[model samples]
Target: MKAFLILEDGTVFTGTSIGSAREAVSEIVFNTSMTGYLEVLTDPSYAGQAVVMTYPLIGNYGICYDDMESARPWPDGFIVRELSRLPSNFRCEDTIQNFLEKNDIPGISGIDTRALTKILREKGTMNGMITTREYEDLEEPISRIKAYSVKGVVKATSCKEKYVLEPEDSKLQEPVRRVALLDLGAKKNIARSLVERGCEVTVYPCDTPAEEILASCPDGIMLSNGPGDPKENTEIIREIRKLYESDTPIFAICLGHQLMALATGADTFKLKYGHRGGNHPVKDLETGRVYISSQNHGYAVDPESLDPSVAVPAFVNVNDKTNEGLKYTGKNIFTVQYHPEACPGPLDSGYLFDRFMKMMGGNE
Candidate 1:
C-alpha cells in the first residue's frame, strides 16, 4: 500500500507501506547501524520514536526471537530505504515485514533514507507521522505530532512488574548471582548479557522503591537507559542515592549514567542534537584506550558538576567532549553513557560487561 512520512518541518516522503496500515506519530530519529533491525524494533528505549535506519538496506537477515530486547515491538514506526523480502540467515525465523505486521507497527520503505539521515544530522531529531492513507492536507497531523507531549516515556515503556530472564541450568556453575535491574526503559540485551554471565536478573519498573530493591538481596544493581531529561527523574535519583551507601556495585548506562551522576551530586543538561548511532568513539582515562560504542540518548552528565569527593570523569565522548563515563572515588559505583551490549553496533565496548562481572567477584 502507498504510505508517506510527514516531518514536522512540512517535508514529506512517499514510500511503500509494509507493516500494519495504521497511522502513527513519534519523534523522528536516525540510527547509523549496519544491522540489527529486529533488536532496534524491540528496544523499549525507542518507545515514542520513529526510527530511520541510515544503512539504507534493512531487514535483509529477517527477524529472530533471540535478538528481541522486549517481548513486543515498541517503536511507534520505522523507516528505511529498502527492506529485503528474502532472508538468508540460518537462524532467521520471520521476515521483518512479518514481525512488524504481527506487532501492528507501521513502516515505510523506498524513501531516501540517506538524505533523511543527513537532514537529521544537520537539523536534529524532529517529530514525524507515518500514514498508510494520505490526506490532501497534512498540516494538522504534522502540527499535532510536532506539539505532542510524550512525557513519562520511561513509564510508558517500562515493565509493569518484575520478571526474570534466566540462564540454562547447565550454564550455572555457582549460586545464581542476584541483580536488581532498574528498568528505566531497559533493553533486553543488557539483561541477557547479565544472564549469560550467570546473574539472575530481576527487572523492576522505573519507580520501584529502594527498599524493595534491597529486599531482593541483589549483589549488584543495573540502571538502564531511557528517554527525556535526567533532572526530571528526581524520584529515581532519590532511590539511587539510597542505594549508594550500600556495598552493592552499581553500574549504569546512558540515561542511567546521567541519573547516577545526579545521585552523586552531579548535574545533567540537554545536548543540542544528542548522540544516536553505532560508531561513537570514547576514551578511557585510566587505561588511555579508546572504544567504539553504541549510543542513543539526548541528555548528558555535566562535566563541570563532577563531584571530586564522590566520583571523577572516566570516559569522554571524542566528538563533543561530553562526559561519557564516571567512576566513584570510594564506592563500587561506575557507569558509562554508551551501550556496551551492542545490538546493531560494534562490540569494542562489550568488555565493560566483563569488567562488571569482575566487580561482582565473578571470574571471566
Candidate 2:
C-alpha cells in the first residue's frame, strides 16, 4: 500500500508501506549504521522516535532474535530506502517485514532516504508522520507532528520489576562484585557485559530510590542509557545525587552520563542533530588515543557548566568536539556518552566496561 511520511515542515515523501498499515507520528531521526538494523529496532533508546536508516539496503541478513537488545522493538516507526524480501543469512529466523508486522511497527520503504537524512541534518531533527492513509491536505498532519514531543519515554521503556543476573559460568567461581544497575531503559547487553566480567548484576527500574539501592550494599552502581531529555528526570537526578554522595564506584552511559552531570550541577542541551551511529570517533583525553564508538543519544552534557572540582571532560567527539565522556574528580566515577556494549557497532570502546570492573576493584 502507498504510505506518506509527512514532516513538520510540510514536506511529504510517498513510498510503499513495509510494516503495519497503522499511522505513527514521532520525532524523526536518522542512523548511519550500514548494518545492525535489528539492534537499532530493538534498542530501548529509540523509544519515542521513528528511525530513518541511512543505509540504502536493509535486512539483507535478516533478523536474528539473539541480536535483539531488548525484549521488544522500541521505535515508534521505521523508515528505509529499500526492504529486503529474501534474507540469506544462516541465522535468519524472520524477515524484517514479518518482524515489523508482528511488532506493529509502521514503516515506509523505497523512499529517498538520503534526501530525508539530508533534511534532518541541515534542518536538525524534526517530527514526522507515517501513514497509509492518503491525505489531500498536509496541514493537519504537519501540525500534529509539530505538537508532538517525546516524553515519559524512560518510564515507558524501563523494566517493570527488578531482576538479578548471575555471572557467566566461567566467572561463577570467581569472587563476584555486585553491581546495582539502574535501568533507564537499559539495553540487555549492558547487564550481559557485566555478567560476563564476573559481576552479579541487579537490574532495577529507573524510578528506584538511591537509598534502596544503597541498602543492597552493592560494590558499584550503574546508570543506564534511555530516551528523552535528561533534565526532565528530576526525581532520578535527585536519587543520582544521593548515589554521588556515596563513595561507591559508579559508571554511567548516555542518558546516565547526562543525568550524572545534572546531578553534580552540570547542565545538558540537545544536539542540533544528535549522534546516532556506530562509527563515531571519540578521543580519550588521558591517553590521547581515539576509538570508534557506538552512540545513540540526543542530549549532551555541557562541559562549560561542569565545575573542575567535581568533574572534568574525559573524552571528546572527533567530529564536533562535543563532550563524549566525563571523569569525576576525587570520586571513583566515570561516565561516557557512547555505548560500550556495542550491540551493533564497533568493539573499540568495549574496554571501558573492563575499566568499570577495575574501578570496582575486580580482578581482570
TM-score of each: 0.93, 0.99
Candidate 1 residue spans exceeding 4 A from truth: 165-169, 173-176
Give the least accurate 10-residue stretch of model 2, judged by summed lDDT.
167-176
Q: What lDDT score is found at residue 125 in candidate 1?
A: 77
lDDT of 2 at 2: 95
Clashing pairs in 1: none
C-alpha lDDT of residue 240 in model 2: 99
Tens digits of per-residue lDDT for model 1 on 131-171?
Answer: 97777987788778878655778887788988877777876
Candidate 1 yields a Cα-based lDDT of 0.86
Off by over 4 Å in 2: none
Q: Write candidate 2's Cα lDDT for 131-242 as tens digits.
A: 9999988888878889999999999999999999988777873568999999999999999889988899999999999999999999999999999999999999999999
